[model samples]
Target: MKSLRLYGKQDLRYEEADNPVIENTDDVIVKVKAVGICGSDISRYKKLGPYVEGMVFGHEFAGEVTEVGSGVEGIRPGDRVAACPTFYCGECESCKKGELSRCEKLTVIGARHPGAYAEYVKLPAENILPLPDNVDYDTAAMVEPSSVVAHGFYRTSIKPGAEVAIMGCGSIGLLAVQWAKIFGAKKVYAIDIDDAKLEVAKEVGADVLINSMEKPAHEQIMDHTNGSGVDLAVESAGSPITSAQVFALPKKGGEVVFMGIPYADINIERFYFEKIVRSELTVLGSWNAISSPFPGKEWTSSVHYMSTGQINVKPMISHRLQLSEGPETFDNLINRKGSYVKVLFYPELD
Candidate 1:
């Protein structure tokens, strides 16, 4: 078996590794088919710490079940599936309330344990979900990240015919564009620093594309909305600047949802901070997509949308590479070297 392991910051090595087996009676082993390189994965690869060498770190993955444990039911060795990757203790107060993301004993795959960036990975049977027969492995793997965007919508009060603005056009932000349109936004304004990403944003569903680097997003949205601003603003960039922009982009009495995780402390300007109070803006913070129902309704709805062709994940895919290209892909992602949108990995390829 071959796997990519992180030795240090920006240090990834593809080497031979032991094959995973069924570890628990409720666990199943999956042959890795497809997995995605997430933006956070690139950030962690460049950060100073939080590095764990010898770990296969990839949570957005899907594959065929190669082995099923004795206690597993309804799923077999040949079932094609994608996993939630959220491991939680059912005894925790948060878990008892069905908020697994807030569970005190939550362990996310790829972050805390070995993930699917290998030939095979072991997971609890309950976490494994069967993909529809029509969905391909690449799209099935995307359900994990897509669910994150879906959960972002759940935290908002966006209604049909409302004007929406999404800060940042990264993977999550671009997906947010699609979900906003699907969930009933009359118009969507996508803001990003990259022109290439803005183009993709337009293709997905963005009615207005504003290059924040070239001009202020708030200014553009105000001009387009006749100075009224958007009804909903979603902050998905997770930066101090983008977060502040989201705060100022909404109209009076509008709602702002922060979905991005800020890497550094954000200092909001006094004027921008006052906008929340003066405009009576509803400010909300959304963490990892967990609701009052375990894995949450977002996951189920994401799968349903993709399986039914109501949402398209193919256009978001920028590159598909073999596991051997893991190191190169990480480098490309860090440097922003290519016009890449989403990168997928196929472990079966050499």
Candidate 2:
């Protein structure tokens, strides 16, 4: 087997390694078919440090089960599946309460464990969700990312016919727009500096697209909303600038969902005094989805959404390269030098 290991910052090597064996009673071995690179991967790729050394750098993946342990049931050797990136012990207090993402021993693939950017990946069978026969490997690899957007929407309680604005036109933001539309939002606005991303947002059904570079996003959103501000604002850009802009676009007593992972401290005084005091706004911070929670039954619903062509991921995949080109893909993404939305690496190829 072969694995793409991170030796240090900006250094990724394709190292030959032994195939992973089932080490736990509930573990399963998957022959990875497709894996997508995420934005967080770029942050780790460009930083200089041991923070992510020895890490196998991929989390979103789809594959076939080659082996299953004694405790595994309901899943067979030949079943195609999408592996959830987050791992939980299933016995923790949080897990017992259906909060799997916050389980005491939670470990995320590609972060705390050997990830999917390799020929084989080892994960608990409980973490694998069956992929529909109609879904392709590339789209199946998108389950994790799409699920994140689904989970975020679940947190905010976004209502049909409500005004919504999503900051950032990355894959997640684009997915959020689609989810908003599917959920019956009356008006959806996508904000981004990149015209290309905004174009994708429009194609995917965003009611309005705002290029922040051309005009102030807050003003444009207010104008569209009749100066009342959007009912719900989702921040997915993961930057202080865009994160701060969310407060300005949401109406007093509106809901703000922070879905992006900010790398640095964000100042929220205006959000505290102005938005919070004047309008009694609700600010919700959403992280990874709990596979066993409220929408537990909807896990399959998400797969169905993708399989039935309700949420198309075909337009999101921008680059597909061999494992040898992994480093270059990381560089291009970090530098924003290429026109890409999502990049996948095929480790099985030479």
Candidate 3:
């Protein structure tokens, strides 16, 4: 099998690797059809993450089942599916209370176990989810990222007819734009410095596009909202600047959800920090896309909406390559060489 492995920071190799096999009674092996690169993958590539040297490196994907263990039921070969790569220690306090995302030992496949960057990967039967007939391999590969955006929105108290401002236009931010509409927002604002991403956001149902390079994002948001600001604001840029700037985009007593992980220290200015106190805003932090009964409604709703043509990921996909291109792709991504949005890999492509 050919795979891209992480040797160290800025070191990704495309080489032959061992294929995964069913190791437990409930284990299952999947032949990778499509997989997408995540923002976290880029971050990890920039600086070493919690991964062993030369481990297969990827997570978001959808594929066909090739083998199943003796205890596996309701799942068999030839099933088209997407998987929840996350794992949780069920005995932890948070897990005992049905808060799986908050489990003390929560983790995903790519960090420790082998990932879906190659032709074959393995997971427990419970992590496998069958795809609907209408969902294709490309869309199914995006289910994990869509579920992540859905999880963040589910943590908010957004009501029908509410206005939303999403402070980013990356892949996660693009998904947030569509999720805002599905949550019944009257108007959805997409903010970013890049016109290309903002255009994609518009194509995916963003009602308004604001290029923050012209002015501060909140100022433009206020002008659009008649000086009132939005009912809900989402920070999905994962940049320290946007993380603080997001506080000022919501209305008084409105909600703010932090879905992006700022890997550096955040220093909020007085103007932005005061919004949290003077406006009595509700600030929330959302993590992985899992909940109570294992993978939860985030996964189910993401696939359902994708099947219905609501959560569209096609316009967000900027690059499509084979597994052999993994090394150079990661290099170009981190070196800022191309107009990359969302890159997907077709393992079957030679």
Candidate 4:
């Protein structure tokens, strides 16, 4: 099997590796059909130090089941499925509480375990979700990241007719904009430094777009909300700068959700104090989804959303290449060249 492996800072190479086999009774081996590169993956490639070298690199994907372990039931060979990237031990306290994202034994596929960047991937049968008959492999590959945006919205308790301000227009931010609209937010303002991304934001139904680099993002958001600020602000840019912007854009009593991962040293004091002084702002951080919480509903609903044409992800896929082009794709993603939105790799392609 061929897989893309990280060697060091700005180093990625396509190499041959041993094909994965079922390791547990609950494990399943999937023949990869499609996989998407993520912002975190690019961050790792830039020497962020979270991803270890020589590890397979990809997490969001969908494929066909080639084999299933003995303990796997309700799923079998030939079933098309999307994978949940997070691996969790079902016996942990957080897992018991339906918080798999916070499980003590949580391990992300691309980050901790061998990931889906290869021709074959081994996952726990529990992590595989069936794809709807109408969904294609590319759209199904989006389910993992879409689920992350869904989890963030779930944490915010956003209601219809509420106003929203989203910072950043990257994959997660753009997806957040769509989810906010679908969830019935009355006015969703998308803020970003890139005009190209802002254009995509409009296509995804953002009510307003602000080039934060061109104007004051906070003031623009306030002006859009009738000088009251938005009811909910989601920070998806993953920067200390945007993190601060979230506090400035939410109304005194509004809610702010941090969907982006900031550096450990980023300061939150000003935002924390603002939350206390102004309208009682609820600051929430959402992680991955707990697939067990809804029993059989998690993957089904996400797939149905795609299958039914409710969520348009095709427009989000900007680049597709063979697995061997992994190095070039990594470079483009890190340098922010081209019009790349989401990059997919076909392992079987030569």
| Index of the highest-lDDT prediction | 3
Off by over 4 Å in 3: none
User: Scored by CA lDDT, what does every candidate get?
Assistant: 0.84, 0.82, 0.93, 0.83
Candidate that would win on TM-score: 3
Worst 10 residues of 4 by lDDT: 290-299
Distance from true position, residue 50, model 1, in Å? 4.3
Order the candidates by lDDT, highest first. Answer: 3, 1, 4, 2
lDDT of 4 by residue, 1-350 (tens): 99987777787888987899887899899999999998778878875744666888888899999999999999899999998878778898888887777889877887778888999999887678888788999999988878888878877878999989999888899888888887889889999988888999899889899998888898897677778888889989998877876788888878888888865457666744565466688889987765566322445666777887767787777888899999987887678677788888888785
For candidate 1, the 10 contiguous residues with the lowest summed lDDT are 46-55
Give the distance in Å from residue 286's predicted Cα in candidate 3 to where it truly belongs: 0.4
Query: Which TM-score value belongs to model 2?
Result: 0.93
Model 2, position 208, has a per-residue lDDT of: 95
Q: What local lDDT score does residue 93 receive in model 2, on the 0 to 100 scale?
A: 91
- Please write out the lDDT profile of model 1 over residues 1-350, one tens digit for every residue: 98887777888889987888776889889998999987777777877423367787788899999998889999998889988887778888888877776779766677667877898988888788888988898888888778888887887888899999999988889888989988899999999998888989998879999998777888888889999999999998878788876878999999998878777888888878998999999998766665566577877887888888767788789899999999988887778777778899999997
Candidate 3 structure quality by residue, lDDT tens digits, 43-69 = 999975547888898999999999999
Between candidates 1 and 4, the lDDT winner: 1
Runs with alpha carbons beyond 4 Å of true place in candidate 1: 48-51
lDDT of 2 at 312: 83
| Alpha-carbon TM-score of each model against the true structure | 0.95, 0.93, 0.99, 0.93
lDDT of 1 at 86: 78
Instruction: Compute the lDDT of residue 107 as modeled in candidate 1.
Output: 66
